[model samples]
Target: MTKPKISIVIPTYNRADLIAESLESILGQTFDSWECIIIDDNSNDNTIEIVTPFLKDKRFKFTTKPLGYAKGANASRNYGLELSQGKYIYWLDSDDIIHPLTFELCINEFSWNIIDFCRFQRTVFFDNFDVKCFDNYNIDENVFFIDKSHIEKIINNELPINTCSVIWKKKSLGFEKFSNELLYAEEWEYYSRLVSNGLKGININKVLIYARKHSCSQTHEFNCNNYIRVEAKKEAALLIVKNLAAKKMLTYSLKRYFICLSIGFKEYNLFEQIISTIQISSVEKIKWQIFYTILPLRLSLYKIKKAIKM
Candidate 1:
């Protein structure tokens, strides 16, 4: 059998009802030289039964997460990376839909040998399939080069680059792996590493994927627990700051770290550790110290504002 040019790695858990649509979208792709690797993370649902019909096509491969492996999307993705034999890697979630021309359009950009990755926009859909909104991160540029400012924007959460909307050359990824320990914000950390390491890529300025926002989504679940989500964001922020420092962006890193510390103020011990460990101007430090002292009042005011809005 001929080797596929692109490997679409999809990590799923108990997505039996939604995965069929994702698989069918892949089957409908305009590009033919691609393989779909569905890594099941020990899903007890009939995910296998739903995907079985698609296996008739040799390009659609499914594997269960090995025993003792971490149980999460990141671990499943890492496993899929190990088993992938394609030249390029695209990460797709089991509940998302890819446009029929996504692979064709992105792969065309690789004609330039210097390109290491490509990213496109995505349209987010609500649970009822209503169009919630579109991510217009790079919608203006035909092919925008990623620079320090762009990296900073991404690290600061000012940009929207989801896993499904990006594709990377397998060789450019080297030994990098997503953080399996993080239940949230793993993508932010992983992408920060990629950008800091000078992984050159372009944004296609087109929507090529449909990201579904549902009650059962991981982000939604994480958001329901503010403390857990904030802690995870802090961890991701720490990693990004460390990477930025390595790249000689100390001031920016400190500012980002400060923001993270502010957000996770409820986690006093962790917040204090981060404040002490990260370097900042003495005046800035004093300001944060004052802010920390008034953190409770700030939180109360924030709650009041939110309650008023509601």
Candidate 2:
């Protein structure tokens, strides 16, 4: 049997009802040279039973999360990476749907493998089939190459790159693993490392995936008050800081780290942890302290505006 040119790795956890749609989307893809690897994170639901029918197709394969591996999507993705036999890798969530031509378009972007990855845009849809929002990733071109200079745009949220929108070259990612410990902002951390390590990419100004936004999503499970989520962001920021510092990128300034920390500041308790983790001048520390003091009020106002808009 010939090896597939692309590998679609999906990490599923108790998504029994939703997994079938995602699989059907893959089956409907115009690109035929691909394999789907579903890594189940010990799902207690009928996820396995739901996926059984899809196994009839030789292109679809399933595996349970190996023993001793961390329990999360990132860990499951890493395991899928190890099992992958494709020239390109697409890490997708079980609940998302890829457009039929998404793989064909992305794979077509590679000209002699000049681009290490290709990131497209996504549309967010609600349960009622209403389009909730569209994330353009701030892309203005049909296709554009991304390098280290764009790192700040990514980290500062100027660009929104989701896991599903990206298709990576296996060779460029050589043994790279997503940070298993980062429950939040793991993609940011992983992409930062990839860019810092000199991986070039292309961004397609087209929405090729439909990202489902439901109440049970992992993002909805955490709020500003969730300490674990906050800590995960902090850890990711710290890792990014260290990576940037090693690259000697001047963008790794104290102010930038403070901005990253600001995302996690829902309460005063996490301030000391932030200060201890980030290295900054006394003046900058004092500035951050002041910013932290006013964050609660600002957050309240933002929430009010968000509710009004909703």
Model 1, 1-310: lDDT tens digits are 6999999999999999899888988988889998899999989999999999999999999999999889899999999999999999999999998877788988898887887888887778876443222233234555676644577677665666678889999999999999888777888889878877888887787888998889888688767876666677667766776677667765745564455455544554655655666666799778877866787688799999999999
Could you list the CA RMSD of all candidates, in the order they appear? 3.9, 4.3
Cα-based TM-score, every candidate: 0.86, 0.85
Candidate-wise lDDT, in order? 0.80, 0.81
- Model 2 segments beyond 4 Å from truth? 128-141, 250-254, 260-310
Q: What local lDDT score does residue 81 receive in model 1, on the 0 to 100 scale?
A: 95
Residue 133 displacement (Å), model 1? 11
* Candidate 2 residue pairs in clash (backbone atoms < 3 Å): none
Residue-by-residue lDDT tens digits, candidate 2, 115-184: 8999888777877332222233343565678887787777776676778889999989987899999898
Top-lDDT structure, candidate number: 2
